[model samples]
Target: MEEVLKKFKPRVVSTGIKELDEMMGSGLLDDSTLLVIYDASSFGWTIGVQVFRRMIELGGFGVITSYSFPISLLEKYALTMQYDFLRDGAEGNLAIVDVIGSIYNLNVNLPFVYYPGSIDSETFLAKMEAVYRRIMKERADSRKPVGISVTVDALPDLFGEDVAMRILRRNLLMKELALMREERERPINILLLNRERASRRFIEWLSQYAEHIVEFRSTSISGVERMIARKSLLPSFTPSEAEFRFEHGNIEIRPL
Candidate 1:
């Protein structure tokens, strides 16, 4: 991967996986928020990390944030995924917002990591905005920026569903609406949620707001997994399922 992004449409980005992107009508829509719902004990979370790293490889910036998962664990598991967060953060390519570390008082000593310092939901979002604004200041620069949330299901656990919904309504759901109003390319958002951790009502509510929804399921009989496209707002989205396996850090998918 080079330090510059390959030529791409202003409102479209690659999911990094060739087969997956092809299924997504050439690539991901800039204004769409993708909600990836993964089954319990599945390898779906790793998919989020791979997508984030791919965005950076495309000469774009991305923020790796999570509520239930922390920076330490992400780095530990991402060792084989070929992404160096600390080094990239130092190089001004990406950042990590550790929600669990900040709210639960966990020890994460990453230099470029941001913590909310308080339990207030507004403050947490403000910290996230600061990260975005700093990157937005790079007007002369050409790198696109994206957002990643590894555990959106845990947000309600922090501030209750009411407060979390309010925050999301102001930020996420409203952002979806704003995208409808204007074609301005804002940050592409990728959210990973565990279906078991969130209530059906809550998941259904969020699903309606998502422009795309992917569900992950793994079978106990074999080492393969299924990545199903439950909902898609892409006009050209036609492929329905992708059967894949983790082969030496790469996802080999057979679109079905």
Candidate 2:
């Protein structure tokens, strides 16, 4: 029998937690997407913020599509770590896409525009693609590998029941687009979903697009939860389970 060759893909993004990385096949593969399901009391927001901070440290670009809370909250979260979130945003290292500000009737004074109303699937995808391209162009001179991290915070909550099905359908399509837009091996896509609030059907469909899945389970005890992290690329992987806490600008994932 003849042996077949496989192309190599590097793992460029790290979860910043040593144990979690060892469990997740040495962090996420380059150009791969991760789906994170977090409960109300878990550290979902911490995961997203850390990814953004990593991008900044690497001199890479990031896009954060906020559908759950104001980007200001993320900024405040970063402040605890002694990070100047506003300075980074002004330098074009990160772009915050505020999708729910207008819908919630809050006056957001950011350099970017907010949807301010119900957002459809089409518009959301377009805005994402545009920000991605703009960032890539700005960094063309550096000729660095396009390391782009996209974080979508609480997707389903962005729309109404009337457009629920449409959003799901569009999400399926967006996943396809994400797979198609891999220019070189340098993209990191992250989707943070509120598992308690997300429908099972929606999750089932979205999981199809995720290369890695990390689920956070809340416990009866406050401020502590369990994390089950797995990688799809490694079929032999036994999901690593751990108890973690997101506090004081740090995430600690300890073996359960």
Candidate 3:
């Protein structure tokens, strides 16, 4: 047991929210995939902010495969998160794989790669593969452990409800993504979605692939929201919920 533990070396990575981190047993296990399911009443935006901000702060990197927003809006996200998107891009700390314009046939002008065509699971997987290879090659000599947090922002917003459902049904893409993350090592992926928009079947299927499931909802107390988390691997930690207040560009997870 001691040898196995030493070989695997439990390296926990933060989500950038201290209280939530404590709830997650001091942070998530390296390479664990966290899926964020949020309704309109919840503070879903903080999902991206916390994961990537912590990754960048740790001298790691972040890759955003966004279908909801373009590069311009992403820049605003960076400013809101207090991180520099362009500077991070230049310094090899960020990569954006854009699929926003593809859904609407608009030519998006951005420094990162853009797939300006109809999106499907195949297209998403191909673009992600390319992005990962690019990051790996560019940081071949770095000793930073190749830790990267990938955010797949608002999938339903990208493919529309029916198409997003079909794409989500593609189990091959999820399997391939899992394999790729393990092969690269320390690749933590956070899949964000609008709970009210996406089908329940799709969410259930996706949850099978995710190591952790985080659902956000509104609370009775005004100005506060709830985060219900379920960990697949950590059985001792049972399902728990946390309350948070989102204001002044910060999310403070309140103690229960």
Model 2 spans > 4 angstroms off: 1-12, 80-83, 102-122, 139-154, 160-185
Per-residue error for 188 in candidate 3, Å, reads 0.5
- The lowest-lDDT stretch of 10 consecutive residues in candidate 2 is 1-10
List, residue by residue over 165-250, the lDDT tens digit for candidate 1. Answer: 87887776556454455434467788989999898878998998887777889866476888887776678887488886776666
Ranked candidates (TM-score, high to low): 1, 3, 2
RMSD of 3: 4.3
Best-to-worst order by lDDT is 1, 3, 2
Please report the TM-score between candidate 3 and the true structure: 0.76
True-vs-predicted CA distance for residue 96, candidate 2, Å = 1.4
> Which parts of model 3 have CA positions greater than 4 angstroms off?
1-11, 102-124, 139-184
Stretch of 10 with least lDDT, candidate 1: 1-10
Q: Which prediction has the highest lDDT against the true structure?
A: 1
Q: Tell me the lDDT of model 1 at 117.
A: 64
RMSD, every candidate, angstroms: 5.7, 4.7, 4.3
Cα shift from native, residue 177, model 3 (Å):
9.0
User: All models: lDDT?
Assistant: 0.73, 0.61, 0.62
